[model samples]
Target: MEHANDITLTVNGTRVSRRVPARQHLVDFLRDELGLTGSHIGCEHGVCGACTVRVNGEIVRGCLMLAVQADGCTVDTIEGLSDAKELEALQKAFHERNALQCGFCTPGMLMAALDLTKKNTKVTREEIRAHISGNYCRCTGYQAIVDAIEEVVNGQG
Candidate 1:
């Protein structure tokens, strides 16, 4: 029998409580339970960074974290960040730079970019690349994405 655990967590500024499977991934729980689909499931592993989300103010691989592990923690998805206007500049920069193609990786890319930008205001291109190395974008060849993030870091965006 599948075990279910009751969890209460804050998501996107809203308090939510639910009973989820013990093994359910945080991203799956967010998408299936709360209808927050901005974070896509890619690779189903931590390496792709496609399931990136903010947990307790830090970026984490949602797919690698169980929903029960997030109990009482604050979770922020792309939808929440966008709704809060926290990703406005990055979104605008990404759009203007044509940083995304298929868009499958945009949400995770944005999350990673936001984390890096928050930690460092003045960043080099190499540093930017290194920061986002975990996120894999099948399209765009990463050149435009790097440019967009660099622009945001340099205050040009």
Candidate 2:
């Protein structure tokens, strides 16, 4: 067995320190070590965005990143997007518009949506589609998800 060592970093606004195996996936570190399961695991090969998380304020697939690589990085999962008091506007829009079907991909979808907003809130339909291309939803036929993103892109939410 490979021996692991301790590391410290900030996660979702909280200070955390722990020892993890060098080969451990960030997804496992977040979900198993830190107990933040919002970052789901679908296609572990990185084809699916289900394990997407923000690393140092940028979106990265957790399944594709090593925990040791994040030793000093700040990580934010879907759980970190909003406080318990209220939901993020995109979340509300998604919920109101029924953006999720099975919800296996909603976390990644939301992460991508948040990033898209940083570029510009007024995104074209095709742009929205392209932004979430990394994420795959098994349900909803995409119309509602697109509509929800449009609501946010159009600033209706």
Per lDDT, the best of the predicted structures is: 1
Question: How do the residues 21-70 of candidate 1 rate in per-residue lDDT, one tens digit apiece?
Answer: 99999999999999999999999979899999999999999999999999
Q: Model 1, stretches more than 4 Å misplaced?
A: none
TM-score of each: 0.97, 0.93
Among all windows of 10 consecutive residues in model 1, the one with the lowest summed lDDT is 116-125
lDDT (tens digit, per residue) of candidate 2 on 1-157:
8979778888998989999999899999999988898889998999989998899989999999998888889988889876642238888888888888789899888888888877765888898899888888889888898898888778764
lDDT against true structure, model 1: 0.94
**lDDT scores in order:** 0.94, 0.86
In TM-score terms, candidate 2 sits at 0.93
